[model samples]
Target chain A: MKKLYGVPGGEVLELDYPAVADYLVQFLRRELAWRGFEKGLVAVSGGVDSATTLALAARALGPENVRALALPHAESSPESLADARLAAEAFGVPFEVIDITEMVEGYARLRPDMTPHRKGNVKARARMIVLFDLSVAYHALPLGTGNKTERLFGYFTWHGDDAPPINPLGDLYKTQVWGLAGELGVPEKIVQKPPTADLIPGQTDEEDLGLSYARADVILEHYLKGYPDRYVEGLGFSPAEIRRVKELVNKTHYKRHLPTVAVLSSTAINEFYLRPLDFRIELE
Target chain B: MVRHAIVQLAPEKGQIRRNLARLEAALAELAEDRPQVVVLPEAFPTGYFLQGGVRELALTAGELEEALTALYRRVWEGPLDLVIGFYEKDEREGAYYNAAAYFELGGRGLVHLHRKVFLPTYGVFDEERYLSRGGTVAAFDTRFGRAAILICEDFWHSITSTIAALDGAEVIYVPSASPARGFFGPRPANVERWRELAKSVAAEHGLYVVLASLVGSEAGKGMSGGSLVASPEGRLLAEAPVFEEAALVLDLDLDRLPPVRYDNPMLADLKSGLPLLLNDLKRVVEAL
Candidate 1:
């Protein structure tokens, strides 16, 4: 048999902007509305992912129906806080600010010796608490903003940044998000800014991952397409880059799934029962 | 000239009554000056992707007729034929099938029933786990012409469509609920792929093709809806917009059929060559 499948090299990361924009907009509007919530909310972290997500939601269900919430800790960059506001203002959505410093500090002081890594996790979860709490108060659907790159690398806090029911940018890689971020009317300064989680001071996502997104995204794409390591290396990527993406993806497999359930019966939720993810039964 | 319509719909998941009511409303909105044939997307009465829920939702032909007659009588007191995909229960076989049924409202209530032959069990699909594979591959007589139905995955395989063509099916209606996956192309890659498939199937067999697809999202998976109709020569008559609910109504000229088949003659040639094929198949079976 001839060679049937291989890496589609030309413009692999390129997207059909118009078609993609319509699909994303419709995705948010239709998914949220069917569940009886016309409103949507996104936790803007001053990153391209959240900004793109916010813009999509605004386009889907008018900006008035979408809320932009920025939860900032004391250690978070002031620039991040300002940029989050810029994103919210650019889209004309109401921006709500909450200082998570007091909440995270409550737990941090108990374990004063907790490393910056643990502190970062606490800050992320604290923001999630505010997000879900407001979801009920505002009657808005919580939309996840984590990009595919961050998700595959397991860079996000488990159930913290990835907890929302609907996500427009979850399928897009970080590199691809930049392309869409521009078309969605996001500010140039915000789109060009170095990506970060903004949980800790002086932190850059590239620095933390030990690889830039440009290098990581290509490696991840080729790797996921079942390209051999040798073939990926021929594409001008270093072995370390390929290994870094592969290891992180394998290590964080559990983060991509729901909690493991021990199947004791034939009918277990998400195990043997196997209901469609969106399956709903209208009750009397 | 037959007024054929593909009503692109986004059904509420697992809501049989609501979906049927929605379909009824869509049909009522169409022009009633002429008799029309309408095709609804796969699983039109109930939403697709009902994993274990298929067993509970599957209805016998009698039960489906009972529900639709009550609901659809409000739309067309005149002649209005319908084609729709649904989950079917076979009481005699005690099996559940992903089936598509054709109805001639003015005449026979149920003309043909085609269960999906291919149950895609790979990647995002779990059809084999829930649906029994359909055994028959033949066409039936309709008020319009000899017609056949191919559910979503059934259309992907060429042999299934070939069998219908060989059985003298002059018109093929495909009701699908395919999800949008790829973004590298100018449209959803599936949209482009379906366009090519529609063209190829219509041109090869010299048959009129109508595709009705579902729109809307379920748990963030958007059912890509680009419902379309192609002429016997593979010319696109009409296409609905993607990711939104829209109706694609067009006039189909069955008179053009004689000229189209005369030009291609692929189906006639196929009929002439079928005996040789059966002989070869029998030899292979004997060797096995």
Candidate 2:
């Protein structure tokens, strides 16, 4: 029942898409150059997040240097593949379609009664394998397509969807991705389509999350700003919806980070160790 | 007409030699046009996000001065004064500071070094974790007049300018290296926010305010370069473009300061309340 584009209080989620586009374009180019990379690789699903990431990569590193591939399972909708191609073509980037059905089925045989979710995880992980191997073969950095709202909600498959080394859309929320997708000239069919994992028939992201992205982003924004539950409830969200989002974020916190390490030394990898950028040579 | 320039530099992370080389090149070129004073953004030698890396990268005041003068003497020299920021480390004291130093290239060298007082530790800034907090905020004498230098976070507090203005400062140079964030319009929200702060500070103290900010992306966090100069009446004289390396120069009419102060008289009013404020501050400090 909430509005599609804005938070209840005001234009909290509103961004200057042009400025953000320029900043992100610069961010990609500089980050790529810092790590001695000249190209970017992205796994495009017919979804807005991947399309936006692909478009940004194409714009930042040129269409010829960016690689876009759709890794689809047998159950993935035909329109999803078509839309993925449409996204890559819209930006003049090269595209390919990889059938991950055989790879996912190999695991299904070991456990005949594997749930649909288990199969989905296998498919997602299979795509990650193809993406990383292709990245190594092509010498391109793999770009992650996960958005902030999904990351905070823990809606992505751990180690599968979150395995990429770089992400342009990881900081942007789902609703913001939709707005950016429109700005990047992604196809209307792709932008307007209901977001889904394409694992099961007629499955949409909202159906699983039990709340629309428009509503969830507003709630998440307020919640992150340290607003109490009572305050968010006053903004027209129900108690049950609030609790579900909170629980998902809390329960799936482990999925967001690298493996937790026991602190054994003064310079533990992620614990006490400083960022490499901090200790880089000063002669440059 | 006392002319000045602010260079919005994009100092690379952990690259002191390259950063110093860039500064040397800028100063060499700037001498031709001949601005009496020049200001550069904060952390002109190393980037602002150096956490534990500060210890390895910091330079002594004499060491930096030697580096610049070595490159500068070959190019040009005149009645030029340079105010630049650096990560300062004192070997004798075994201490490090985020400091801004004012150098009189044509006359007495190393005029003043103002260490940052407010090292912000909240929301994307982790300065307090790696830097030693500065204690004093005082104005020093220049050929133009009394001037003071304030590093990035120190300017966030009104007391820094209050101390400078009371110490008979006519101009305050704020060298900042803030990351651009919070987008809402054609520009980053920082563009608007910085202007508002500059104008308010200039008007409140009836003094000229020069804001020199950095530009570049370090690990994807961008420093929007919108360096600017404001008049005593809170009017923006010139602003450098955001997110690019550029310089803004202005000619100031020093005669404007007295009239602005005469009309507003806010500083004059505060002079009478100093004792009360000092007493209250003492009580607050004792309690803490």
Candidate 3:
């Protein structure tokens, strides 16, 4: 029998920008409206991922319905703030600046020996608090901007950037986010900027993660697609890099889920008490 | 061995004449390949976004037969078969159906008309409100080989594909007009999801699964055109570009079908387990 299969390892995975943009816009609009809200709030950090999310939201629920919040701290990059403003103006969405330095400092007063990581966590949680509070005040849902790479590496603070009700960019890898940013007409400077959590001054994402997002995305894509470690290594990835990626992904598993409750009965809340939407209760 | 041509089109909404013209032009272009079988996207004649105007856009059974016969005479030669999707008006029942018809060149008329069994009424789809459901699934002998036709949502249900395969379908043609959705990574998420479905069906059934999806946008919702041809061994033979109009011609080797089915006897296992499944189903229903 003749082999009809094409050559192996030649498949190229790419996005159709126009189609993807249209789909996401429609999806966001439908989901938000279905949940009984017409407005959305997106925290813009002036990075490609958040900018893309903000643009998509604005396009979905008109710019008048989308609000941008720039929560910057004393240690935050000034360039990030400027870029956030630039993005807001470019997309014609209303934005507000909330300095989080005082909030972070007030929390620091409680513990004088706070490490940089812990301080970053405080800033992240403080921003989320502000965003959520404004979500209620503005009658809008808070949109998450964390990309797939950040979520996989546990780069986001739990209950901080990850606590938003809706996430449009959560599935996009860091590199793919840049592609979408270009398609969404985000400012070129922001799209090309080095990705940073902006938790602290002078800290870059690549330096903190110890690898470039391009390499990390490739490794994570292969790993997430169920490729064996040996096969990924054969595709020009170092074993050490693969091990690091796997460890980060494994360690972050807890952050992706809610706290587990003990199950003592058949009708445990988490297991048996499924989501309301899952129930097939029909109206007569 | 048979060469199949899968045409991915972006039909104008509610414009049957223009859409047919476009399809005729595509068939004329594809004639150079001399494909034994040609498949087009679902609802290519009247487009997929027909809600209130479906009855107006639908074709009576005889009208559809006449249109197809005319099209076949214009573009096809000896033994060239075409599988195309349209909205068929059931004159006797006074209802409409999402249907696919198989036309063999130099034959009497439409060899088979498979109505879509699953009419999705969920988000973005109000098919049930506009069209009645199909009731049968069977495979028939074609010029290429034993083949079956399935409309978009019909192939999503695994049981439909299983029944087709059990009825001795060596090749399953799925014509879809699914909109593009979700971009999780480099690839469109909807396309990835479809790939998983196609691969599972082809691998388990040990037959070729050919999908031809429509492209273009309607009312701001876009259809990602990533038509695919998967082998019995669950390998992708050819994949067309997404969100673009393209015709893919792939030469399929039918000789590999027997060896693949021998290696993986999934069908045999399913056939053996049917009695037990039926018994359990009866018991469960009775208890309920």
Best by DockQ: 1
lDDT score at residue B18, model 3, on the 0-100 scale: 67
Instruction: Write one digit per residue (lDDT tens) for candidate 2, span A1-284.
Output: 87678645553897878778888888888778867799999999988999999999999999999999899888899988988898899998899888998898878898989998888888889999999999989899999999999899888888999998778888899999988888889888888989998876678999999999999998999888899999899889999989988987899889998889899999987677666452486543
Q: What are the models' TM-scores? A: 0.95, 0.93, 0.57
* Tens-digit lDDT track of model 1 for B183-228: 8766788988898899899988898889999987877778999999
Predictions in order: lDDT: 0.87, 0.87, 0.84
lDDT of 2 at A100: 94
- What does the i-RMS of model 2 come to? 1.9
Residue A57 displacement (Å), model 1: 1.6
Q: Which docking class does model 3 fall in?
A: incorrect
Best candidate according to TM-score:
1
Clashing pairs in 3: none
Q: Clashes in candidate 3: how many?
A: 0
- Write model 1 residue lDDT over A1-284, tens digit each, in one string: 78787766453887877778878988887788778899999999887888899999889999999999999888889898899999999999999999998999888899969999889998888888999999999999999999899999999999898898888888888988898988888999999999988777898999999999988998988888888999989989888888989999999999999999888998888877877777877665
**10 residues in a row with least lDDT, candidate 3 chain A:** A274-283
- For every prediction, compared with the true complex, DockQ reads 0.67, 0.55, 0.05
| Tens-digit lDDT track of model 3 for B1-288 | 899999999886666666777878888898889888889998888667766466667887568767766776787777668888888888789989999988875675678889999999987687897789999999998876798999989998998999999899999999998876555455677788888889889999899999999886664456777999999989899999877799999898999999998999888888888777998878987999
